[model samples]
Every structure is written in structure tokens, then in C-alpha cells.
Target: MQTSEYLTNFSAGIAPIPQDQWQALAQHCGPFLQYSFLNGLETCGCVGGTTGWQPHFITVHRHGTLVGAMPGYLKSDSYGEYVFDHSWANAYHHHGLNYYPKWISAVPFTPVTGPRMLIHPNADKQIIVEKLLEQAGRLEQFGASSCHLLFAQDFERHNACHAGYRARWSVQFQWHNYDYTDFDGFLSALTSRKRKDIRKSRQFLQASGICIERRGDGQIRPQDMAFFLSCYQQTYLKRSGHTGYLNQEFFEHLLKTLKNRLMLVIARQGDVPVASALFLYDDKGLYGRYWGSLRDVNGLHFECCYFQGIEFAIENRIPLFNPGTQGEHKILRGFEPIYCCSLHRLFASEFDAAVGEFLDREAPVITNYYHQAHNVLPFNATFRAQLISSPENKKGHF
Candidate 1:
């Protein structure tokens, strides 16, 4: 057999790559990895320059044909990445080392788990993934301290570990659908107490005259995005004292190119939208990415973000709903604890051994917490039994 030459190139953005070729591989990866969503991030100024996320998109070619690609960035500071590596950066600073400009393969601000090393099905999957990871870790050329692949999909986890990257684990709450027929069918799987609580919240919201409607694709008007952007920025300012990382430009771009994957859970009081939660979804799953409100209506967050998403998933037969990160409140609402993994390759032996030791110590703690959180889920006994036998739990995905 003749050997095929595989060529790889890293660029500051995906502009040089043909959009059709990129979209060919990205078709089913998810909304985050889609060319439009990522390129929109760069074009809208949500990432790049002083924003601390420097785009370093990687593309792999076979005989001049685009075969695989990875979205990456040269990070100056750990600001928008939800993986939380400031402690690692601080440790480096304490030891008289620089951690700034570490390379990462991720969806910039998105913490959702999806494909990182994307390859066409006809290509050699294992070799292409290995090639992509090996090239991504070539940080010495770029003066980066290390290379990390964040929120990587599970199939790539072993490939990464095989490529000499240390594995790190964290837990995010997610809701799963098991052939549910409707919203009430989902509630029947939960414990009596928790089921009643969800019912109570929904009923209360109904009586409060807050109409929650999901608008998507062409139904999303310019004013709707303007309102969503306003609520997003207001919430960010109230919580972090600044406008959010996203701007109107980003949402505008989304409306044009990625609107089909976008859904807005809007809460209105008599034709006036008060709060909005933006979600991205495809045939596979729904991701509750961003939400904000101009007025504080009781139980509005749960309805607009969680319940509505669950209902939509049931209607569309989507299998999963990942409602963002770091919310213990989600546990009581039936979101299962699932492990989200990141892989790292450090150039320096000292930091490699150090971070490896740190990860070794940290893994067990996160595992124990994941198991502990799973025990507290408000699922009924039968549902818990089903979950135990489900592939996600059987494979130790928790």
C-alpha cells in the first residue's frame, strides 16, 4: 500500500479555509464547532486581540483535500474558559514561570462538550486524531507553555490520553431523555416530591401571567435579539460589573448564519418580553448557553431555561439537555451529574510532573463528588435503575 501524505497547518482564523470544506466535516459535530458559530465569534470581536483569546484554528489536509480541523486559541489569561485554570496559572507565576499564552483547542467561551479533532468519516479516524493532537501540542514553535484540549468529546478522550496528555475531570449537570412522550412523561420519571415541586413552579408561573414562548430561526426578529442582548448585558453588568463578552454583532451574525440552530426561551408579560434564555441545538441535543432578565419574576429562571428546554427536547426527540455549568440547583431539578473532561500536554518536565500530580490528586475528589451528587438526584427508584443500566452511567461517564 502507498503511504498518503497528511499535511497540517495552523492559522489565526478559518478565513483561508473553504467554508464548504469545513462545513462538510462540521455538519453534525454540533453548533459550537460549526464554521458559522466559530467564525462569527472571531468576526464579531467576541474573541481575538486583547480579549485574551487568539484564534489558532488548525486544518489537516490529505493530498490537498481538507480532512480534519480543530478550533484553537492562544490564551493570554483564563477569563472566559469555564474550565477554570487560573489556579494553574497562579502556580506557574508563584514558581517564576509564565502560563500566559498557553494554547487551547476549544470553542472559546463555549464549555459544551463536542468534537475537537474533527475528521471526515472517510478519513483514517485514529491517525487523523493523533496527527491533530500531536500538531496542536507543538507549542515550542509558538512560545506557548502547554497545550490543552478543553471539553473534548468522550470518543477522543482515550485518543488524547494515548497521545500523552494528562486527563482532568469536572462535573456538569445534564438532563437526559429516554423516549419521553411529553413534559409530563418526563415528570413521571422523577420522585414524587421533586415532581410536585416542578409542577408547582410551572403552575405558579402560569398564574403569574408570564407567558413563556420559544422563538427560533426566522421567527426571531431583530428586536428580539436586541432585547436578548440587553438582558444578557444587564445581567453581566449586575453580576460582573461589565457588559458580557458577546455583543449585538455576535447575535446578529448568528441570526444570519446559525439561526436554525438557535432557540430563544422568551418570557413575556402581556406582549412585552422581560427575560430571555438563548439555546443552541441540533438533532442530537439542546444546550442552554446564556440567559438573563430585566425583571425578577419568581421561578422565571427555571421555567425559561430548564422546563422549557426539557419540553422542547421531548417534542423534538433530542436526547440530552446540558443547562450550562456550576449549578447545584439543577441537581434537585433532575439534571444528572456527568463528567466533563479536558486533556493537557505540558512541555516542561517539571510542570508536567507537577500538574500531573495535581490532576491525580484532583481526579479522585471530583469522582467522589460526582458519585455523591448522583446519589442525590431526584429520580424515582425505577428511573434510577434505568439510569444505572444506561450506557452513559455504565461507561462511568459520571
Candidate 2:
């Protein structure tokens, strides 16, 4: 597709684009959208191979100068994407249509919302968005059933919707920093019962002789990663019948390449690590990406995953914390409900119409669920009033 002086091109992999050029368009986005992170997934065998994700990154150039790009992948299954599309696949199956291969613009195994369409500050955003939609539509030529962009930012979702994509909504629990001075300051804003429960959970950890340590960037050692991987594998093996989706190599690559953006919170008993939580962040927000523990302690999970994250965010002045996808348990710990969006375009008109109808009916339910979750937030009446008075609440963005 052409946009004035620009032309769109699709690469078999992210490797074709120079790292500097790709990252230039990703300025101020997020770590997940960076060239090193997405390319690391491919180089480390996380996305390519049998992992069902095959890179097909899209880029736009003006007179051979890169201007915009999107992280695109050809999928063989709906396994890693948090956006569930199995029902749609089954519908396609019943109709004797193939849905194995579909196009998606998302970071592998990441649910945090950020910019999916990366355009240079100087580029024409409207033209870039039009080229993006045109490229997605061209997926039909490859026999793909649909193209999807998951966990897209608000503006990206709006542009995609205007481009004739159907919007699907989901809810994720996230913590917002409101200039709290410390962890106690945060808890004081919560209801008495919630404040007590959180205090008790942390006290329980302390009484159990568990101490938490935060390791950022170069502070994380190789041995620490080994221990964390053991916990990660054991947790997955116990929960599911197999190991987790990521491998030690993938994490090692992450540590080596994106170490500066990494945060590792370790729960230890007198220098012996028992649990670990790995987080990633940029200037905008912190993402609680993964966590695991060797032994089950009464309150260790909440301490390592939720409380420590809150404390870190408070101390660091990070405004947002996404502690992963689902957990009603987060509501009690001060995570508020926020709407996450994904856009879809099915190649088949019949399936497209059907899925659009399904989304049209489902969107209201998701919105209602988001509202219902607010009722269960642990914020006290006074704090809730302040929150409701904020501009974000008025806009319904949170």
C-alpha cells in the first residue's frame, strides 16, 4: 500500500529491519515494543519454531527511510495470545473453514497494553494507520482467516475501529499510583479491613523469616535466574502437566539484552531464595510479567507479587502497575479494573459478520463487568471519592 511518499513492506522476520531504525519509531512506547525484546523472542526460539508464532513484521518507509512499523506474526494456534479466539475458531471449523493461520500484531505472551502501530513522531499518523489497515487486509492473499491486534492502546484501538475493525473488550486489574508517599500511605487509602489484611499478609511473611529484595538491571545474577527458573518450572509443572511457555534461554536472552528494563523481586529466607517475581518497565508503567515460588507460604504469593510491586511503584514513582492478566484477588489488594481492547478483522465476510455481532453483544457485558469490579475495590469511601473525581474516571478510561 502507498501513502503519499511512503510505501509499506512486510518482512519475514524483524531481523530485516535495522535495530536502530525500528527502535527509532518505538520511542517512548514500552519495552515490549522495542526491537531488542521482539527480536530476542525470535532469536531465542520463543516465537519461531513450533511455538505457533511466526514473525511477519510490517514496516513503512518514506524514500527508503523507515517511518512506521508494527510487530506482526502469523499464528498457527491461539495458544499464547491472551485474547481468546477458540470459540471463533470452532465456529470456523463447524463451517468447514480453516482458521489455523491468522495474522496478529502483538508481543508474544505479553498482555500489557501499549502502542501496536509504531510511527515516527514526524510521520503522518493518519496515512500510516491507513497503510497498516491495508496491509492487514492483504492477509487474505495468504489464505489467513483474520488479522488481530491485541492489547492495543486507546488511540490505536480508535484508529483500527475507524478502519472497519471490530473492537473486543476485556478487563485487567491494574494499580495506579496517586502520589502516595509510601506503602503505608497506599494502604491508608484502602478500607480498614483491606488495610488490615494487607498488613497481616506482610507481617506473616516477616514472621516467617522471609525478606524481600529488589534487584534491578545489573544487580540480577546468573545464579538468581537459575533459582527463579526452577521455581517457574515447578509452578507450571504443578499447575499444568507441562513446563511454562518460556524457556531458560529466553529469559537469559532477556536478561542479557533487556537487563536495564528488568526488575526481579526475590523472596528469601536468610539469603536462600524461595520465590521470585520478574517485572518489566519503561518510563510509563511497570509490568508484573512472571512469578513463581519453591514453597507455598501462607502469604508469600501476595507479598511477592502484589505488595512488593506496590511498594516498588510507590518508591520509584511509577504511575501504573499491571500485575498480569486475571485475578479477582487483586481487587482486594487495591488493583482497579481497567478495560483492555483488541481489534479483529476476519477475511471471510460471513465469519466477520458473525464475530462482529458476537462482539457487539459482548462489549456491554465486559463494560458492565468493569463497572462491577469497581464496587469491589478496596479503596475507602474518601479515597474512592477522590478517585471518582479524577479526570480519568470522568473519561471512563480506568
Candidate 3:
């Protein structure tokens, strides 16, 4: 396989690949290796240089056929990445070491778990690993601290390990779907207390005159996008020193290219949209991506992000809802803790070992935590028995 390095230029010959090619590749590679969803990030300038998500994508071909590809970035600052390495950066600063510019292979501003490497089904995994490793070596000359692969898939784990990268584990909460007839069927599976609690949380919006509505690209008006963007910005502004990476162009692209897979759930008060949550879906699963509320209404967050998503999944027969990363709040609401893994290849031996040790220590705690959390599901003995006894229900339990 011949490897080529494409620098982070948005308008170069190596422009955004066509959606058909991406979908074909993703189909050959599998569902999570989506092209339309990923390339949309570049075409819309969401992952461009201005956003500190400069693309340094890697492509490998054999006999003039695309064999393997990796969507990577020359990241200046780590903002949207879920793998928190701020402590490592601070440690580097204390030791007078440079750590800002690093290499990361991930979906920018997205923390959903999926494949990082796109390899043809017949491609040699070892060869792919070697080429990717060689690419990581380039970062050292550029004074990068490390090359990290965040939220990688299970198959990529072995190859990354062979490439001498350390593995780290993180947790995110997700709701699994069973063959429920309706929302009540789902609610019936929960304990009485939990069932009532979720019902009450959703009902609270009624008092605020905030009604939930589903709007797609066709149904969305211009003002609707403006309101959605406003709420999205508010989510970042509340946190000090935060800047949003995406712009109106990105949302516009999503409307154009991914309208069928997109759903914008809005919370409205007297015909005014106050809060909205954006979700991406396929036939199998629903991904709850970005969401924010204009007004801080109690229980609105759960209703808009979780309950609404669950209801949608139940109605549409989508099997799972991944509501971003790192929230214990979603646990009691029937979201189970799922493990997300990442692989890192640090340039420095000392730092590499340090991170390896850190992950070693962290993994056990995460494992035990998941076990403890698994016990906290709001389902009673009967519901639990039914859920466990049924293979389909068990599959949806995440």
C-alpha cells in the first residue's frame, strides 16, 4: 500500500470526498465509519483551521484503490475531545515541556463511540497499523507531545497496541431499546418510583408552557435555525473561556446532506422556541449530539435530551440513544454505563509510561464503577427478570 499525507487544507484537491463514495466505503467498513456525517464537518468548516481542528488526514491505497484512511487533525488546543488530558498538559507546563500541538484521530466536537480507522474489509490490519504508526512518527519532528486515537473500535485496539500505544477507558451512559410497543411499555419496565420520577420530569414542562415538537430540515424555517444556534451558543457561553467550533454553515450542511438522519427536538413556550436538542440517527441507533436550553427550567434538560430521545427511539424503533459523554445524571434515568476506549502513542517514553500507569489505575475504578452503576437501574425485580430473560431486551440494555 502506498501512503499519502494530506495536509490540513480544506480546499485542496483532497477536498471532501463524495457522499456516495463515503457511504460505499462505510458500508464496506460498517455503519459507524460514516462518510457523509464526517465529511460534512469539513465541508461546513466546522473542523477547519479557524476552529483549531486542522485536518491532516491520512490515506493509503493499493493498486490505485483506496484501501485504508484515517481522519486526523493537527489540534492546537483540546476543547471538544472527550479524553481529558488537561492534567497532562498542566504537568507538561510545570516541567517546561510543550504540549499544545498534538495529533488526534477523532470526530471533532463529538464524543460518540465508533471506529477511528477506515480500512477496507479485505485490507491487512497489520499493514494499516504500520502506515498509521509511520504517520504518527511525523508528529515528533513537528514537536508534538503525542499522537492519540480517541474512542476507537474493538478491532482497532489490537492494532494500536501492536503499534505500541496505551489503551485508556472512559464511560458514557446510553439507553438500549427493547421491542416496546410504546412509551408506556418502556415506562412499565421501570420501577414504580423511577417510572413516576421520569413522568414527573417530563410533565414539569407543561407548567412552563414549553411543548416539545419534532422539526426536520423540511419543516425548519430560517428563524428556527437562528434560535437553535442561539441556544447552542448559550451552552458554550455559560462555561467561561469557551468558544463554539461550529457555525451556521455547518447546520446548513447538515440540513442539506443529512436531513433524513437529523431530528431537531425543540422546547417551545407560547409558539417561541426556547430550547432545542439535535440528534442523528440511522435505522439502528439514535445519537443525541448537541443540545442547550435558553431558560433554566427544572427537568427540561432531561425531557429534551433524554426522555424525548427515548420516546423517539421507542416510536421509531431505533435501538439505542447515545447522549454524548460523561454524565452520571443519565444513570438513574435508565441509561447504563458503557465503556469507551482510546489508544495513545506518546513520543516521550517517560510520559508514555506515566499515561500507561494512569490508565492502568483508572481502568479498574471505571470497571467497578460500571458494576456499581449497573445495579442502580430503576427497574424492579419483575421488570429486571423480564429484561434479562428476553434476548432482545438484553441486547438493548447496552
Q: Indicate which candidate wins on TM-score.
A: 2
Residues 75-109, candidate 2, lDDT per residue (tens digit)?
Answer: 99998899999999999999898997999999999
Clashes of each: 0, 0, 0
Least lDDT summed over 10 consecutive residues: which range in candidate 3? Answer: 5-14
Winner by TM-score between candidate 3 and candidate 1: 1
Superposed by TM-score, candidate 3 places the C-alpha of residue 398 at a distance from the truth, in angstroms, of 10
Candidate 2 weakest ten by summed lDDT: 389-398
Pairwise TM-score winner, candidates 1 and 2: 2
Worst 10 residues of 1 by lDDT: 389-398
Off-target runs (Cα >4 Å) in candidate 3 are 1-21, 27-33, 216-218, 241-243, 391-398
TM-scores, each model vs. reference: 0.95, 0.96, 0.89
Candidate 2, which segments miss by more than 4 Å at Cα? Answer: 1-4, 388-398
lDDT of 3: 0.76
Ranked by lDDT, top first: 2, 1, 3
lDDT of 3 by residue, 266-340 (tens): 898888778998888887778888887788889888888888888889988888889878878888888888888
**TM-score of the candidate numbered 2?**
0.96
